[model samples]
Target: MATFNLKTVAALLFLILSGCATYQTKVNDARNAIASENPEQAVALLKPLAEEESRDQLVYLLDYATALQQARKFKESAQAYQKAAQIAEVQDYYSVSKITASLVLTEEMAQYKGDDYEKVLINAMNAVNYLEMGNLDEALVEVKQLNLKLYKYRTEAKKNYEQNPYAYYLGAMIWEAQRSFDDAYIAYKNVYDIDPNYGPIKADLLRSARLAQRPDELSKWQKQFGESAPSVDLKNSGEVVLIFEQGWGPRKESRPENRRFPQLKPVYARTQRAKLEVANQSATTNEIFSVERVAIKTLNDDYARLVGSRVAGIGAKAVLADQVRQKNELLGAVAWIALNATDRADVRQWSTLPESFQIARMTLKPGKYKVKAIGLDAYGSESGEQMPEREIEVRAGKKVFVSWRSVR
Candidate 1:
């Protein structure tokens, strides 16, 4: 009876030892697969091990979460990390729990629909904790470090995106933050090639590509892309003056085709007495002549031309005003000073403005100012000219006004 009992005990011990050996072998294989970048295989091997009662479930769960994250299954990785954190907490593994929590938070942040910069930052801190754990292999430590950088980039990406949705080039920006120039180049190229207009994103894409040392790619894109669209130019050089006249015309949509020609109505005028500081010329010349006439087709066109002209005069100073039909009407008009152009100068439209009827006001320094009032018919055709070059002496800081009236 004693012999029989000993045999039974030895057989049971043998079976237990064999099971332990098999589990260890499987864990090693899973680790090897992950090292080889076969995360899918690693995950398959680790999933059953994680569920096995005899296995070290904590290790298996951590490995599985890492694999899931590598696979870009952020939601599932977050769940696994959550489980790991809970297990570590219950086991009184404070350090492990913190690291797992951080991983979970990182994954969670990646899944967030809105800005997650703070959460990503927190995750990066947790990754640092894992690095200090000493139990993880060097490769895993490297991954943790890489994750730290990725999270930071994600945070920055979210912030930039929030600030400017049009800056969707942020995807490439995040990749570039990871030092993955190839990935960043691809991402930026995608944004650049997208059909939707993203304001400055195209330029950003080109700039990033050039920074990545892809001059050929930038050149190719430049060849394909058109010139940058024009914008309003505003700069003031010297004491430039603009006198705006208020009037209304028929809407383009309401006008007949044949009658929709460019109008020559005088929108504003300047006296020959006004002075302009031309670049590189030492002498202040009275070459500025009174504007005999000006015309605009639409109110927005007029306003855009006016504002852009004003903005273009950044290097020059402007004392200007518009003749508004009423004080309230002046509030509706957008005003800007244009520099560089001498009196009697002909300036073309740079950008189109909104189409609407509006009023304006003009303020000028004490001086003799010449004003021209021109009118446009409903069809944008030049109605006969009105008040050609009216001269008025403006007191310092006083308001100068001019207006155009449409003939019936």
Candidate 2:
């Protein structure tokens, strides 16, 4: 039998445990900054790790890109998002070595590849970044990539994968901006199919149909909606879309009873919804996607796999400890304690993700108008929190985009 060095094993375990904690600590600090509505501070905290390439670079990139976007560093944010898309992708088949490490130590022992829904969100958010940069080609490319991945997911990951309404809705907006009314209509149909009850879906469908010259679809919607397709004077009225984020995503907390699996808990939020006001008219935002629900559901969906892995890891470690104990009881006991100490769950996530995503749209006459994002409570009352007034020049026959975030 090979001789085992108790001191060496203990030292190594200490390093791994402390290293994971340190990295998570940095991410938590950044998350706190974001929650405080100080995105610049959050970016400063994560900028070092996010700018570098590392094993945990995916986490750094996701949070960093979000922070940069909130800080209005769109170009730099786009670069981080681009890097994450290219390099941090997790493949279907992981390396044996990675699996071995995870089994021997912790799931976090392997690389921190993002979750399934997160991967799709990356493409959608990247498309937004490209749109903000005025690069229509790249924006469209990102949307196309998002749909392709969604299709693969339907056949590969889940046989009956439910469509993400937000992704398709975003694609519709982009297509409309590019004046591809036909394509926009198709994407809007996907969104409508996924969420027939969404407040703005009907209006968007009617508008796209009229613009695309689909008389039959327009008449069909007109009858079903019990309203006529509102006239869209393409040469006189411009479209304005406000994509806003509310609150912050939940935080992961390790339980004392089961450190091997972390529990997700909601983070506090002072703002729930927002209203976009321009000139004299305003539109109330509606929820499109919810990160809180999605995050909980994602973890719950993985519970079975996590349980299996945890049981196998503990069993293997217990057998090894018993083998060593047969030779030397004290060393065997030490081994058991040390091995169990590293059984921590990987609690890392995209810390800067919002609790939910919302949108508001308006058709305005051509003018340079001041736009305001006024935060509101569940009852539609002002919440005393607001975004700085920004100006938007609505050009005739064109669409424009604006985004805001509220977290306190």
Candidate 3:
């Protein structure tokens, strides 16, 4: 009887040892599979162990969650992570245990829905709570880790859109926030087509798609979405104020003869006729004029005549002087120019003029003109006669304002 009892006891001990060896081997294999980045293999190895009676339930759950995450099974991975977290809480393990749990939950929440959609939503809510509590970095870390999981969820949800059409809509929002507009557009469109009762999202998707064709339209849509349109400031006076910057010098004479002749003489003799001929020529023809050292005779002409005559390249220079003298007459006068809505974009054309002037104000047509000061020696005779260019546009009955700055 004693010998029989010893044999039974030894056999039972041997069986128990063998079972432990098998469990340890399987656990080690699963770990190795995970190390190799083969989540599918790890899962295949660990699932049976997780179900076994001898293995630690918490260890099984944690490994399973890690494997699912690696395999891009976000929903399942999230559930497993939650279970591991619960186990950790039950065991009172805080640091790495809680952190890992929170990270998985956050990522799952950010992802599109899957079979574990409810869990994902819960975790996402928790993540938001954590973020609100000033643990943003940790919450973000969770979001980062779940990228692959979310991608898998998106792919799966797309394949079965009828099961949850809302997934595509949510995906679109995620993509839009990330600035992936193209993908977002498609996703939103899908949601609109599949589910008409999606409330404002359908209209929003259509609007976004239309506005994407033009930037201006996009701005309008954005304003409408925000429930605030930009205010347009309209001036009732129909007058534009021209503020001039000081510090422009007169055109320097190219030669001594430039100083000898009256500034009006050379301009009347040469420049005006040349410009008229050039203006009359066919647009296709390209003519080049060589400007050697040229001189101006004088600066004395009404605005109309000054604008008309092109002598001595003096038409532009004459216009510049007239503008200065007119401004000086006003004594701290400012030039006002009338502009139409179309004129705003063209106002920069005035900058092409010589250094003697700057644009001050802009208004639509039907405006008046007020000029300021023309200082002495404001006009110069030099080798290079730097004349300011005129950029003022005037319509019938509308006034434009301009100011002159003397060149030192």
Candidate 4:
């Protein structure tokens, strides 16, 4: 039984490690295409791997869905996200204690249950897609799902983890659009409660109070903000809410655990903030909103716990492999090699995601205007030679939405 178990473990480890290498090679081309603003190319590259939902490649599905959305294929994007969510649902069976096999092998070997943030964001992105297509009812449904997921995660999160304020903020925006001022007020208030320092929520709370005709709430917010009710100036013009998704989000990399055997463990490399400039082409008026670095996903915490377990498992296996080697040199050699090979990091992630989300709003007379998001690097220098600019038509009494993704 001992010999059989060791051999089985060795074989499983070898397969898991080899799988990561194969997957990276397969996706490298697709990743580059996305960076070049050619999501169509990425979709073509990733579609074949994503066709089989039973394979449970959530990462592949996520990339495919993002590319489809970027290419303006909203319906197809939503469908792909739905399939990815289904695969992630299977992760519920793998309780923390049940992850022993994963620790002994590789995190990639475990079912790809999305992190809490990723789960909520799946709904959030779908909501954006639905809204962009002018499907208000469908967008509302997605926002409601996002809130419910956040509530559940909040209840289950460890003490160190906090609920996402952006999720609540987005829900509030949806309610505001629906003219459900009461619901919007409540959602905005929730955002305030989670992150009082978030500047945008302060303005939103005040606006919701005024719209809801809650005098007491209005007074409370005014005192909190140390100012009067900031006017929206929507009487003559419609509002354009410009959301800029700046740069490529963090990606997973493997690092050696120890100096000797050097068991590889996964870590995340977060992208730096891009200095963005928002401008209107007609008047060339611009409003600069600084991007806040929100911890949308707690990768550090997740990696710490995972790496700790992996280290213990690797150490135990190393001892056993040494014992087996003394008894039979060939078997021990094979076992040792397999153990090292399987010490691969879990590199799967939603790479197209932005490092941080930024928002800017402008009140413009319902007319056509060209809006531009000029990307700048850390040194306040132009990052993209050809800036990303889009033409938008703003209408009176309605909010126009524009989004730009600058994944440099």
Query: In TM-score terms, which candidate is top?
Result: 2
Report lDDT (CA) for all predictions: 0.36, 0.82, 0.35, 0.66
Indicate whether candidate 3 or candidate 4 has the larger lDDT.
Answer: 4
RMSD of 1: 35.6
> What's the CA error at residue 144 for candidate 1, in Å?
16
Query: How are the candidates ranked when ordered by TM-score, highest leading?
Result: 2, 4, 1, 3
Tell me, what's the RMSD of every candidate?
35.6, 2.3, 39.8, 5.0
For model 3, the stretches where C-alpha displacement exceeds 4 angstroms are: 7-12, 19-24, 52-55, 91-408
Give candidate 4 regions above 4 Å deviation: 1-22, 54-56, 94-104, 156-160, 232-235, 257-297, 315-327, 379-381, 385-389
Candidate 3 local distance difference test against the native: 0.35
In terms of lDDT, the poorest run of 10 residues in model 3 is: 341-350
Better of 1 and 4 by lDDT: 4
> How much is the lDDT of residue 339 in candidate 1?
13
Candidate 4 minimal-lDDT segment of 10 residues: 282-291
**Residue range 1-408, candidate 4, lDDT tens digits:** 577767766675656556656355667788789777788999999898788643337878888898898777889999999888777666457546436555655666566666666776788778768767767678778878877776666675434445666667766776776778899899989888887877567778888899888999999989989878777655567766655565655554555544222121222222223333334232111222112222223665565676676778787668868887887777787777776666666666665565566666666777787766556555555665333566777777566666656666
lDDT of 1 by residue, 206-242 (tens): 6556656677877766676764322211121112222
Model 2 gets an lDDT of 0.82
State, as a TM-score between 0 and 1, how close model 2 is to the true structure.
0.93
Candidate 2 regions exceeding 4 Å error are 1-6, 12-23, 90-97, 255-257
